[model samples]
Target: MNGWSNHLIVAPILVPLVACAILLVIDERRRVAKAMVSLASTIVLTAIAIILFAIESGPSGFEGVYLVGNWAAPFGIVLVLDGLSAMMLLLTALLAVASLVFSFARWHAVGAHFHSMFQVLLMGVNGAFLTGDLFNLFVFFEVMLAASYGLLLHGSGQLRVKAGLHYIAVNLVAALLFLIGVSLIYGTAGTLNMADLAARIPEMEPDRRMLMEAGAGILGVVFLIKAGMWPLCFWLPTAYSAASAPVAGIFAIMSKLGIYVILRLTMLLFVEGPSAGFGAQVLFYGGMATLIFGIIGVLASQALGRVAGYSVLVSSGTLLMVIGINDGAVSSGALLYLVSSTLTISAFFLLIELVERGQDAGANVLAVTMEAYGDAADEEVPEEQGVTMPGTMAVLGICFAACGILLSGLPPLSGFIAKFAMLSAMMGTGAIGVPPTAAIWSLIVLVILSGIAALISMTRAGIRTFWSSIEGTVPRVLVIEILPVMFLLGLTLALTVQAGPAMQYMDATIRTLSKPSLYIDAVRTAAPTGGDVKSSSSEVESN
Candidate 1:
């Protein structure tokens, strides 16, 4: 492979890091230059992401493992660009572009470091996805969380600050737990590289193996907290609701990062032996409980932001459940569901902000008049000249409807196609002697009910925003803001139209994920330079 192609893994992390650093030195007053640099960086990032995805999605077992500084594996930092990480990088780049464009409307000017902080956030997310070692993962996690803290509180508001603080505290605890777990695992297993750990575990002494298990258990809890699983997820809604529109939209992928880790680790580490799939039962029940709670939250939500938050929980919960199920078919379906849902909700959050802006002027006035006098007027008010509605509102309305359809798993969209794949995988096509397992039955029920609840929530929120007797003036929406939402929803539409090929890709990726041996062998023999191998306890050393 050519040098550039071989190093595709680092491109995602590097472009944003360099751009944002340059942004930091530029005076905040130079808005035009900053935007230009930021846009150009995102364009490059998208190209790099597409390239990496293409490389990983090629012939089976192909992965780009860049050992930093040309050092050998386990001893030096290595970046693994595989199908899963590449897919995440692509999704994140798309989100970054959309969020950055939307921020240009007004949010970008809210603070001095908005552009830099955004690029830093992308750098962290891409790093976390690309890192092949446990320690680097934690470092990347901290980076992402720190950037998020600033972004969440970018705009001046008491509620926003309060929510940001809460987010900070919760994640602080997760980080601490993350450190402890990593320390324990490194001590027990004697290496931080993921494949090395997998290779060592099977040969480790019993007591050390038990210690590793305990550490992994603690680490799993950290992922659960980040995933916003059930009781641990109380902070997600408030924080998401309080953040500015573009920030909240980008934050949609944050939780999915946790799900991605859990899926990766569980598949890689727990492939055989007594502890195979160790956390299956907990993830199964916990995931189901989370889905139930999310359904309740969606049904009871009063605001569109809160509804978006609960939808995140639902998405996280579904992936967790599918992981627990541990079947190739289920995993493939969940992967599709993951892509469509993230794009749908990211666009939805941005749409909510635009729709709410229009209601701000006349919302309270309409409310008080309705309570006191039964209506804005005893009779209908006639339309007046020069009161023409902004075409922007119509665009926002269409995007919102598309989001609703996607979120609720309605037909003629990728959402329905994804859910149908999952359901079909669970229950075969009318074989008299075949019967679904209890877990499959329960999952089927929860998935359907969650869709129904999402429908109800979106319907109520849409009606209140669009059909209420509010005499609000048309909101002055910007073309930049509307374009991002269209772009994201348009991606969702593309996924729908291309479901067949998408599902095939998903199936191939899942097959690879199911085979831990394939991953272990790839990593073990990955050193490009000649290396040494020791007795039963193997180590690779290169000159």
Candidate 2:
């Protein structure tokens, strides 16, 4: 049992891959089989994540690295199960399961292979989370990207195809840059393993140091592109809006992939000293810009889908800002925000799809009702085919309110907890320097402004759609369609109840990340060579 527990680190990664493989072989017409595969895999993955979290909660503080084939670091593959990875794995599992549940009825609406592609995408995301090698990160990233390519255009309409092209072009460039950066790092350090590279980084020659920094900087840009940071996020709203509802819901979580890697690499490998790196300033500025753009875009857009897409851009910006701030409190806050915002946004997206569909089916029913009531006097009656039910409108209203409040960091919500944590971190008694102070303040203002914009737009839309007089009978919302939204609401409430423990866990995770020597030592000791890598181990000490 102990041996099995120690090997649990690989399960999160393997479960999804195995599920994907099984899904690929299943008959697409066998919807039951596909749903079972997805649900069972997600449940098992979530269970494993919870178990790992409990195991890491013990006095040791981390589960340590799980080396594949007993190969030591700097040579063999490894998967590190630290606090960050465990938390992320758990969050991803939760969201994935929620998404799968939402898709129970809607999967066929999208297509036959939708579930298969979804599982493949999950495989990529989970693999990325568990990988301890930088090169493997690239492989997982590409895996996710390829699956996304299929999912994004699953419906294959003109708009989707066009939007997907833009998404593909941008990500391809980012992937190339990522590969180039990794090659440079490997060429200079003579190793591709994260732990070993961190140990060797401080001892590199001056020129080599500059080369690696350049590579890291380029790599940072690649992640920023993935994270939808300013100037690079132009394609996000369009592509996401054009995707099928379920695919869009899943993609909302996908944007976090870049930020996750940035957080991991920045703290674990790049935190040598102030003079040793460019700091997180670039990320901060980019995030702030992206936030502003997203707010403006949200306000400018009328369609619910596009509005939600822009909101995602804004959330991504805030997340990157927190990462760039690089304080333990800030990072913890970001993690909290990341998990909450993703759920809220995903729920919102799912709700939008339901509303859109229901509206289409209820338009005529609503038009007739409006004619009978004679309330159509001043209003432009919606096309009979486009009207939606009151119940569907109510659910949409609730989801929008939740998403807006949570995304904007309002009090008594998960988003607020995350924001407050970040604000506390940013105000940390001069730790971030004067420049950072200005940046932090700017971010705070941006967050408030964006929230206000979102509130106004969403409220206006909700009032017009839900409260205003309509001519037709409301459409019925399927239980499966509403289940995911309710689950997300419960999650948001749970976050509030468990805020204390959640924050503590995030803090501990950040602290563990801030001190990588403990991680390096663990890997060294656990290596098959049994701490034989003296130079690498000692180099970390000097740093």
Candidate 3:
């Protein structure tokens, strides 16, 4: 293998960092030039991610760590590349590409630091996915959140700003919780490297363990907020609805990042600890409530953006519940569901704008203005409709139908396969004598009811927007804008087509995740590759 192959893990983070820096020097008005740079960076990042995914998922692959600044694990920064991180990096790249492409339609130009902030957000997300320690996780989380604040208010509307302020305030509190939790853990356990902490936790003193538990509880609260668990997620729908289309599309992945951390850390740090998911019951019930609450919100949402935002809650809730199930078998399917649902909701966010364009913004003002100005001749021109059915309407309709299928977990798409896999995993093992577990039953019931709610909500929204709106003007959508939506949905279809291989990947991922020993050894004892500094594994013991 080539020497640089060893350094592949860092590329996802560094490539975007460099791109964002270069973009800072460019004039914002040079839209095409800036876009070309951003596009190129995304292409490169995606290529590297695909390569990493293939290598990590392939036979003979093993968990690998890249140490930063020659520092060893438990004491220094390291990036761990495993199935979970590899998949997340690829997912982030794909979303970045689609959102960046869609933004070229107008959102990118409307913002002052669109490209720079977008790339910085990618850097943060990739770093979060790859980091092997809690400290870097917090750092990257802040970076991602900071960039999102600007992106959320990109279009500078009053609603967006108001929601942005609320979003900022909420996250700052979450950040405080995160810091306190990490500090407590580090103070008690003497390390923050997840794998090392996993090793040390099983042997900690009781008083320190009690302290750690309190800290971990606070951390779980923070994650639930980030993951959009119910009640804590009251800020989500409004904030997301207020963002511009492309920005909101990328933000779909943000909540899932929180879910990923919870899943990853719970599997690693708490798998063998005495407490073993101390607050898991809360997560399970909270997730159920979140799913139910999201369904109700979806039903009540009058705007398409609000529905998309609430759908994020649905996806997060489902994953949280699945993770809380604490079964490695069910988790495999949950991972699949996570990928499909995130892609679907992102496509939904982008589709909402295109779908709403033709709807009356406020009283169909252009026609009224024309009539009021006594421009009777202008109104008499009978407003050209290109053909019997406009192409834009047809394209938007097709995309909307696909999003509905994916979101509702309907057939012939990955959503159905993912949900079905999860259901089978949950129910297949019900014993002959014992009543079904409450958690399992609740999961089953909520999953079904949520789907039904999504179906009804999408139907009503579709009918109002598509069927009854024949008199509404045809939306003018550019090919660039529409293509991103199609690409995202197409990826979901591809997931459906390759369900066999995808499931196998998830199976492997779950197996690795459930065993903290492998992760611990890889980080604390494994030899460093890439540009990482070499150090002794024994440092973990001393540290």
What TM-score, over all chains together, does every model reach?
0.94, 0.89, 0.93
Clashing pairs in 3: 70-533
Evaluated at residue 364, the lDDT of candidate 2 is: 36
Error of 3 at 447 (Å): 0.3
What is the C-alpha lDDT profile of model 2 across 1-543, one tens digit per residue? 246787898888788788888988888778888888888988998899889887776335567677787776656788888887877777777787778887787654466677777777887898898888889989989999999998888878899999999999999998999999998887777777787888778878888877877788888888888888889889989998998777787787788888888888888787874324364788888888898899999888767788888988888888877777766677778888888888888888887776665354355346546657976776675556864555666776677678777866788888888778777766665665644567778877887787788887777556545665243336567888788877887898899889999888877887888887877777765655344434544553444
Question: After best superposition, candidate 1 residue 528: deviation in angstroms?
Answer: 3.7
Query: Of the candidates shown, which would achieve the greatest TM-score relative to the real structure?
Result: 1
- lDDT assessment of candidate 2: 0.78
> Model 3, stretches more than 4 Å misplaced?
58-61, 362-388, 431-435, 528-543
CA lDDT, every model vs. true structure: 0.86, 0.78, 0.86
Better structure of 1 and 2 per lDDT: 1
C-alpha RMSD between model 2 and the true structure: 4.9
lDDT of 1 by residue, 1-543 (tens): 346798777888899999998999999999989999999999999999988888777337647778777766677787887778888999999998999899998899978789898999999999999988899999999999999999999997999999999999999999999999999999888888887787778877889999999999999999899998888999998999899999998999999999999999999888676568789988888899899989999998777788999999999888889899898887899999999999998998898888888776456445645657866567687867885445776677778889989999999999999999999988862355578888989999999999999998887767667656365556778889999999999999999999998998888888887777777666655665445422222543211
